[model samples]
Target: MTIKDTAEEWEVRATETPFKGNKTSVRTDDVVMPGGSVARRDYQVHPGSVAVLALDDEDRVVVIRQYRHPVRHKLWEIPAGLLDIPGENPLHAAQRELYEEAHVKAEDWRVLTDVFTTPGGCDEAVRIFLARNLSEAEGQRFEVEDEEADMELARVSVDELVRGALAGDLHNNCLVVGVLSLVAARHGDGLDALRPAEAPWPARPFEV
Candidate 1:
């Protein structure tokens, strides 16, 4: 049997939206179980997201520190943002995020990995990209507000970030996943063997 995620939706007897937010909403579904029993599952419905792991010639990763109210901590993370529009091209979104968050642009791009953040609680799929050949973006930096207003930026080596992640110091989902995936790719067949940046993402389909 192939060890890959397959899409197969269980029978939904009923579904409802109890709460609706600006970008996401709470969804409750009465699903049929294996024993012919019905169960209610509530989860957040998100529009999906894209993240960029910008690697410089020095082998450092661009990172940002920002406040997350829900977690009540200033977590260090890579550049990431929501898809904004349904079926929006993830590569474009990732590039925009890298520029806006880190004022960086990349010449080489590849699909690092894709993941489901908090699958049990939210349907938020994130497509992480490996962005290399980095250079500062041209033009004024994007203005940030709220938690982002106090954001901090840094570039740390891949090894240090991996250390922090394993030491239980770094907790950002994107950063952890991105860095680890980067390490894995380097150790595996190699970065060149990784999927193309525009590779198909069944989790969040987008136009070329």
Candidate 2:
């Protein structure tokens, strides 16, 4: 049998949206379970997201530190952002995020990995991309406000990031996933064997 996740939906007897936010909503579904029992499951419905792990020639990864109110901590993370619209191209979103968050651009791109931030609680799928051949982005940097206005930018060696992650110092989901996935790809079949940047993402379909 293939050891891979398959898409299947259980029977939903009823569904409702108890809370609706600007970019997401709380969804409650009365689902039919085994033994003919019904259960209510509530989860956050998100528009999906894209993240960029920009690697420079010196093997440093571009990172940012921002205040996360929910977690009440300034977590270091790679460039990431929401899809912005249904069926938006993830590669484009990743490029935009890398530029806006780090003022950087990349000549090479590949699919590093994809993950579900909190599968048990939220339906937020994130596509992480591996970006190399980096350079400074042209034009004025994107303006920031709110928590983003206080964001700190830096480039740290991958070894240091791996050490920090293993030491339980880094907490951002994207950074952890991106860094580990990059390491895996490098040590596995190799980076060239990774998926193309425009590879299909069934979790978040998009146009070419």
Candidate 3:
């Protein structure tokens, strides 16, 4: 049966944002679904985030080993950050994140892909960028806290990154998706086929 069928119809009633934080918000919605059944869905609302796939001259990718307290493991992830500033541009945020997290910058950038971090639980839309022509920010020091305080940066070949990701060696969603998107575009339609860094994001619900 299709979701449009009467058996799956639902209507939302009261919606409220009970908690608002710099990074997220707790939104609770009262609804009646599944043919008059009542339900309440509480979830986090995020302003969205950006992920950078920075490729150096040799085509190696920059990754970081940061501890994820939720998972209790030091996981590998690409340089990324959230869109928290009210007036900040997405491209500038991507550039800032790469520089801040990995101490690097890029001369070329494009929109590689976008992802819904988890639509079932949150409206956390994520944009992935493809960055090349990289340069190291001189004397760049990462000012991260908590689990990121002891982060270790590594540059690995794209081949290895792709293989490792495909073999389930890496766990970060952004890293896996970003790496695969770049690899495909590089060898398939070419990086020029990607959308501009300022491409419109229909899934981005927040203003900033």
Candidate 4:
């Protein structure tokens, strides 16, 4: 079907912010759907994020358990954080997050996958990276407090991670995508297509 589409296809009439949080904001858009019906589209506007899938010598992936108050579950997840900095590179952000959350630095870094967390109701996007050749970072000796205090990290085999994702046991979006992406890549080009460390992310929105 040769269907030509444009912003008019979305039929967005106007938009307004209802709640502006410290890191995110909620916006509602008045719009018309494809069938000429008017509607309201509400979504959270986010600045995006990065996640690191830390790999060890045994080919296991690092997983962390954290308490998510919203979901009310101490879900196991990969090391990840929001890209909240003004001009920090996403890879640098990922490296910092991996060290902060897991206290490990990787000598080899490659893009694993990029995903939109919840495109239907949120603008949150995350780029997951694969980091190998790991070692302890001396800068991670600081005392943990707040959310970091109760977090636990461990290494799980890549096969197990992929199994958990496929069996619907892994709920964390980044972990699921990262594990599957690595599995797929191993069966395919093996890192021949991994993006550079300084890959340009045009999808990351401009700061307000």
lDDT tens string, model 1, 1-208? 7798888899999999999999999999999999999999999999999999999999999999999999899999999999998899999999999999999999999999999999999999999999999998999999999988999999999999999999999999999999999999999999999999999999998899
Ranking 1 against 3 by TM-score, winner = 1
lDDT of 2 by residue, 1-208 (tens): 7798878899999999999999999999999998889999999999999999999999999999999999899999999999997888999999999999999999999999989999999999999999999999999999999999999999999999999999999999899989988898899999889999999999999999
Error of 1 at 188 (Å): 0.6
**Model 3 clash tally, residue pairs:** 0
Across residues 37-137, which tens digit of lDDT does each residue of candidate 4 receive? Answer: 88999999998899999889999999999888899888889999998985667888898898888888899988787777888899787889989899989
lDDT assessment of candidate 1: 0.95
Error of 1 at 76 (Å): 0.5
As a TM-score, model 4 comes out at: 0.88
Question: What stretches of model 4 exceed 4 Å from their correct place?
Answer: 1-11, 35-37, 140-142, 205-208
* Superior candidate under lDDT, 2 versus 3: 2
TM-score per prediction, in order, is 0.98, 0.98, 0.86, 0.88
- The worst-scoring run of ten residues by lDDT in candidate 1 lies at 1-10
lDDT of 4: 0.85
Indicate the TM-score of model 3. 0.86
